[model samples]
Target chain A: MNLTIREALLAFRRAPLLSALSVTTIAFSLFVVGLFGLVAVNLQDALRGVAERVEIVAYLLPGTPIEPITLATKDIEAFPEVQSATYVSEDSALARARAELVEFRDVLQELERNPLPASIEVKLRPRFRDADHVNDVAERLRGFGFVDDVRFGRDWVEKLDRLRQVAAAVGLVVGAAFAVVAIIIIGTTIRMAVLQRSREIAIMRLVGATNGFIRRPFLLQGAIKGMLGGLVAIGLSYGAYTLINRWLIQASFFSNEQAVAIVGFGTLIGLFGSAASVGRHLRRV
Target chain B: MIKFTNVFKAFPKGGLALKDVSFHIAKGEFVFLTGHSGAGKSTVLKLVYADEPVTSGEVRVSGFNAADLRPRDVPMLRRRLGIVFQDFRLLEDRTAEENVAFALEVTGARRSSIAARVMRVLTQVGLAAKAQAYPRELSGGEQQRVAIARALVNEPSVLLADEPTGNLDERATRGVFQLLRDINASGTAVVMATHDLDLVRQAPYRVIELQEGALVYDSAVDESRDQAATP
Candidate 1:
């Protein structure tokens, strides 16, 4: 093992031009895989992050008593999928409306008492926050006589699902394309290495070196190129992602803290995954 | 020890290169394999190294059946013998020392051992000073010597030289032949194939002559001449 590595390193050092060409080919292929990986992860994260915030709001009838609203909120909280639930009194809803319309807050001192209806806001656990889960909870809320309406964004949920599907489909197509490119590039590199050292191989055979021994360095070269290429792609993609996140923050898409929160741990997994897959593909050569 | 029994070799397109050939070389005996250009001298050397399979009949070299040897075991067979090609097939990218060291490296020898053996063989071939020079930078003689050093590094029992001095001048040719003689005297059997009849005549050794893919003569020159002169 030590001798194989030593010889491979020596071979690598001696063939600087071939080494550089191989690594460059590896890096370019890795970059494409990493780029696709980034898009897929970010889209999935966006969809999942939104689902985690999905909540159901059930507005009560105008004449419903505060006690029933409180009781209904407690009932919803007891469901296995429900994480938490709270009653929003009519007065609190009116206050929120006034805050949202600060420019028109006066308007003859809001003319009459707060007109918004009392509502129950129920936060579902992550597993119960998808479209069907929310709809199921919505139907249960509607069963109550005092409940006037139960709503969450059905259209937005569908849009998010479509985005996830598109992301997955595109990820598969692009990932496969990048994978093919990576293999071809690495195979061609190793093939050239083989051609360049044909005399060496022939001599090794003449010296009674087994086929395994002669093929070892080429396999090692393939593995090393794969690993290095993956690392280069990861570094470049991560650097680009960080730069984009910074630009978004500076452009006021979100504050620095918010932007940090939006770029989650998934992106990191994605970068490492892209590297590992590319490395695996290249090792076979 | 090496032996061939009615061995025949026919190329796919070139027809029979060796007819029903039969010969044997005992251990610790240096023999010259010589014939004209179209003769089967090189094919006989190739059989010993198991480079070409016999079309029929048995070829046993160093106790291994050459005709039935596995492809994977061919390298192992080669490692036990040293073969010098007419072209001095040295890696152009490697220095003389590196070319020799490469052989040891492929055999999984320790680096320190490889270095020591390489240095020792280079000195033996009178190329220790040129150890750092690439094959392209060396003369034809030096390149062939490097090739010989590579072949010798493994300390193979049999040394097969196929027209090793084909590309050298008279001085260099004499040097290579002397080196082979010295190596043979040390008890490693040397079987050299060459068309140079003068070298064979000058060098006091058994000569095996081939004609039309068959052994036409296998005996000491003085014995053959005495028999012919008496008849």
Candidate 2:
């Protein structure tokens, strides 16, 4: 082992209580952020599920020729934003109404003549499922000669868009606030660790140890503490997620990428926090 | 070798800690820096070690000038000089041997050679048998010896002791004083700062006295003057 690494590990053994305190402080701070991350991930998942129902339905004119309707379906399908387009004839629409509308099945069955209009249902790609894209696709559908009307629940789509915007803004602001808080807390904790060993630092300097040499062990120690804290936080987050899933509601845990990101965030904070603290101390002394 | 030429040091707030004080120590010479508390004894040592900046004038230690020494060059300058304080200054957690080895380790000495070098210094300090004892487990004299061993492990040319026996009992103080004399006998220059008049009188080494931050007497010059006036 390298001397820096040996010294860093020796510090943990020398002051086990302080080391444990630092790790716990980091872990709890990260746990809060992890909890918020879980909420954001789940919220995004739910929003995506809701957005999948967004569709543009175009009612066809009575007696419209089927040939142009088929051609129109192909044109709608070719639209960049359109994921798929399905045509339902008037007779089939009536049959679907009877099958789906339980209370209206009798009324749909008793129809003397087919009153239901044929329609083309347009489903947009995932990225294009927002209000603007849906409205654009609907306007294009209305341009068809046989399209009598285009309906895609404009108010509902706009509301969903608004909700999405608010969620993103809140997530950004709150997540940043949480991150800053975590950084400050972790920095203070690391500062305390530095202060506790100030005597050792003074001794090292007296013995002709360069500033760089003295700082290396501290940086390594901080990074290790942060990594351990991050792992513990993830474990805590998982436990929370499991409890929520078991008792509160159906919820999902972080994906592998997300979990790794949380840990990397901790490591970076540890590195920077130690750097700032040690840098300040060295300058002062 | 160390030299101070008309050095002036001011306190951070105000007032001079050293006023126009100057002296020189040749290789392998033993000197006593005697003054009451606050008489700039520690200030002079700090200036020599580059622990404090000289307000004005020159302080050259082992060929490094303190007037414009860069921060990075401080460690290099100190590497050639060993410093011990009144408070032993040993890490409480480390054993006597480990404490001495720490000095060598910090200078990036060879890993294979650290153990032997540490033991040699410990034995020289007459604490080889207690190498595994922690500071708390040892007497004041033994702890100070450990500190001396740590200082000597690097084989510095000049050893600076600032009240090295201030916290020791009479017997321990005498013991540590003898060890310093032995170290000096072996060709290492020793500049010991103390107000222990008895210790200063016990040796025939040159004595430099400071009064209120100003050099009052240097025996090397004043004593020669006394002989010339013998008539």
The CAPRI class of candidate 1 is medium
- Give the alpha-carbon lDDT of every model: 0.78, 0.94
Residue B88's lDDT within candidate 2 is 90
TM-score of each: 0.82, 0.97
- Computed on C-alphas against the true complex, the DockQ of each candidate is 0.74, 0.87
Error of 2 at A58 (Å): 1.7
Q: lDDT (0-100) at residue A114 of candidate 1?
A: 64
| Candidate 1 chain B: 10-residue stretch with minimal lDDT | B216-225
Residue pairs with backbone atoms closer than 3 Å in model 1 (clashes): none
What is residue A127's positional error in candidate 1, in angstroms? Answer: 5.5
lDDT, residue A69, candidate 1: 74
Chain A TM-score values, per prediction: 0.75, 0.95
Best by lDDT: 2
